[model samples]
Target: MWRCKMVDLLIRILPVSAWKDRLIQWHVPGCAACSEKLAAREEAMSVLVQERELVSVKDFWPVVNRRLRSGVEREAPPSRPAWQWVSVAAGLAVVILTSLWLNRAPFEEASADLTQKLQIDYIRIGDEPARAYVFQPKGVNMTLVWIEKDGEGE
Candidate 1:
């Protein structure tokens, strides 16, 4: 029952100005196209307002301080920095393990094969008492001296 100009004046003053009763009345009754146009206009206006530039950060600080003082607090969760020491330690561990593994000889390799290949006689001894046997693996003289004494258990 209010005048049409009264509704327009109210729309100009309200914050969410587009969803007024007068506009909805015409747009909802017999026109889908008009309703779509109104929705599109509202969306466009909202995007334009967001994209608009304000004054510098200096001028903006007062507004921010006012909001903060009014108990409007919003914060992001804290985050940790990248794992430098953990990564370095992991890398060092990997390097150490790789070095150890690379330096080791396999157990299944024949000692005779290595002795013959190297052309040097290296001897291995056991805990027995009779003789020092000589092994010529590829004609390299390797001796096994059996010491017949309780060297440590005596």
Candidate 2:
């Protein structure tokens, strides 16, 4: 299968040399697959040659040059009106100013009373027999909790 694929690729990409012709002559006759592939490739190449013959080489360059010359004469796109741009800029400025005014004080200052910030009414214990101890060490703004099951000894 790989050999068949390699021959297909070589048929298209290989240069038109005597070595390629000799290879096809020697190998294609022995393999029906190779012979079929060669016939198909030759038929395709002949079709391509026929299509190529329809386009005269002498006329190709002049047609391309004429198109390029006409392309240069095409008008440029019209510019957008100045007032539309000014109104768009004004609208964006109004949106930015409104957002800034609304978010001027995003966060309010904390209350002076510390009790209002950290309030604890009461702690509830579950049905399991356990002891809970809460500690707020001095000089630190944090609290620590410790729980001990009734049956466990430390």
The clash count of every prediction, one per candidate, is 0, 0
| Residue 51 displacement (Å), model 1 | 63
lDDT of 2 by residue, 1-154 (tens): 6876776677678888776777677667888776764457667787675655666556677888897788966776655786788889999999999987886544222222342356444444566667666676664545577777766685
The stretch of ten residues in a row with the least summed lDDT in candidate 1 is 143-152
Best by lDDT: 2
Candidate maximizing TM-score: 2
**TM-score per candidate, chains pooled:** 0.19, 0.23
Off by over 4 Å in 2: 38-154
Candidate 1 residue lDDT tens string, 1-154 = 2444464466667566356755657534555544444557667777774534744435778888898888748664443434666678899999999987876555224565555465323433363443333355443335343433334345
Residue clash pairs of candidate 1: none
